[model samples]
Target: TLNSDTFTVTKVYSDASSDPQVGVSLACDEGGPPVTVTDSPQTTTGLTADFTVTGWTDATQVVCTATETSVPPGYNSSGTCAAALSPAGGCTITNTLNSGTFTVTKQYSDASTDPQVEVSLACVEGGSPVTVTDSPQTTTGLTANFTVTGWTDATQVTCTATETSVPPGYSSSGTCAAALSPTGACTIVNTLNTGTFTVTKVYSDASSDPQVEVSLDCDESGSPVTVTDSPQTTTGLTADFTVTGWTDATQVTCTATETS
Candidate 1:
């Protein structure tokens, strides 16, 4: 009389809290029908299916393999799929979550030179936020890399950038809210501040003051102004100057010379 033996297949998940559970199909080399099962929610336990086959003389060897038919949104199968039937007569398959990487960049615009500004980048997954700093920035900009492991593939991640320290003559602008993409980047922008300068000339000897010429020169280019005061009187003379483009903290020198 040929006796029957039972073979079991189990599905195990590394992340028990994973939603939309994973499913797998199990098959054996022996003449038993294939069985399919879904993983249990508990990490310590697994879901199982049993197959009964006849013709076992105690020397029969059986091999089984498990294949993932469906995976959760953000997970991948990362364990051995094939195994020989153990003395206990069962096999297990494991599934692991997936991970991805991205970048955060800082950019400066409208500035005469690189401000070398410092900034902070914050990225958030479902859990806590991850923050990093980029200092001594350049005109070409700076970048920071981030890697998030053990996350589901469909999970949404967000990032934001802030200027920790702004240069004396610059202002920040533009939107920095970025969605995470593999090998992608989020950028922040800054512009230079602008203002006007006024120069006033007062003559100590009003009645006898000679016709004079006044000139103003700045260390930075495109910031020079010259004015002529003819037939000077008791009232002082004033000249308004505006820098053509952007200017940082600069040194200005003014001089007056008698023309008559």
Candidate 2:
């Protein structure tokens, strides 16, 4: 029939008519060019058929998230959105590799004085009981060659207690050397008690011309004491007297009778 030849109304050809569009439109808003995902194979979901880039004239933003190949009903392919201006955001992916390590030595310090005594240490990477310095040893019997207490840590470290003559009751050996060390030599000390002596003279003049005597006195408690010329050595409180002569107190008299 010639009516079937009428430029078939089966598909109308008009630009402004109720007809299906035969071509895409270039009329887009002033927003963005758009993001094109050419490698995605989820084209089965017609909702993901197209994507529009919005709100960024500066640069395109991509959010990273996990997505499904076959999307379920009422669900859209989504990922975490951009929280800040960071690079990680909307519609992107990521993969992390192995990690690394960084190290820095820390100094030991105190609240007030930082680093007092020298704390020298040697150690391995991950081991206990670090190597450190040890203290000095003890000293004995080094005084003036007889008693030793302290010393310097040097060669020939000799000390002295000076007055080496060890008086009685102090020590059998003298005082230590000024520079005392552990390995000092020993010396002998005088064991006998030692002192001084003096001599005095007098007649019967009681307290006036008092006799000079380092000898033994009357007693420990006796006052206005008397002494003998022959000084005597005594042990502690012990006393002894030697009286060979004395002025006779009864021999002198005042005679009032005239003599012929």
Candidate 3:
């Protein structure tokens, strides 16, 4: 058997030829093409076929060769194929043109995806979601108001100030009160939120001891008297006076007389 570029099978005749033979025919693995029979897989460079059934056993060896046809412009590539006795036989076909690419690719964010912890004042135990924003509590002067505004659920507001600078016995859990000292320097704190509130710096000279008072008012004008106590206008006129545990702006004009 001989090879050709167009994959057509070419037959070689023996010395003892045609006229002496009783029968003569050709067969291929697949049905023969019009003129040539394709007996084996196509030619791969540098490798040979296992065996070929070219008829009678009279010839010691029937060598089958493979060849490549004219490969079009970009289609041409050098390749090799080996013969195999079984399915797992070592018949490997490799490409000659080490050109085009066969690629496999994979993409991946570096954001913080952790849970958060929120602390709030909470009006009725827990109603809606309202968080106290980050702010400072103690400011320096008088009219400077520290506003802490991050409440999503509170309607009416109430606050508290835990005395930080005073001696150990001082403790407060109420709203803020604005009281101007005789020297005109004072501190006004609004504990309307959960965290440390921001302090507004209003220029004043209130150099007084750390005495806190609680003043409850519906709004700025109402003055509903946070700590219920009557301050008889006497010795030291302070927004903070002592009657039981109450102090600060105690004379709220009486809630029953008007709206106070």
Going through the candidates in the order shown, the clash numbers are 2, 27, 10
Ranked by TM-score from best down, the candidates are 1, 2, 3
In model 2, which regions exceed 4 Å deviation? Answer: 1-156, 159-174, 178-183, 186-193, 204-260
Ranking by lDDT: 1, 3, 2
Per-residue lDDT over 74-116 for candidate 2, one digit per residue giving the tens place of the 0 to 100 score: 1222322122112322222111111111111112211112211
- Cα error of candidate 2 at position 145, Å: 10
RMSD of each: 8.8, 35.3, 29.3
Candidate 3 Cα misplacement greater than 4 A, ranges: 1-129, 167-260
lDDT of 1 at 156: 60
Q: Which 10 consecutive residues of model 3 have the lowest summed lDDT?
A: 101-110
- Residue clash pairs of candidate 3: 5-69, 135-196, 135-197, 136-197, 136-198, 159-174, 160-174, 185-205, 185-206, 216-226
Residue ranges of candidate 1 with Cα displaced over 4 Å:
1-61, 67-75, 86-97, 111-117, 124-141, 198-260
Question: Cα lDDT of all candidates, in order?
Answer: 0.50, 0.24, 0.25
The worst-scoring run of ten residues by lDDT in candidate 1 lies at: 36-45
lDDT of 1 by residue, 157-189 (tens): 666656666654456664466666643466667
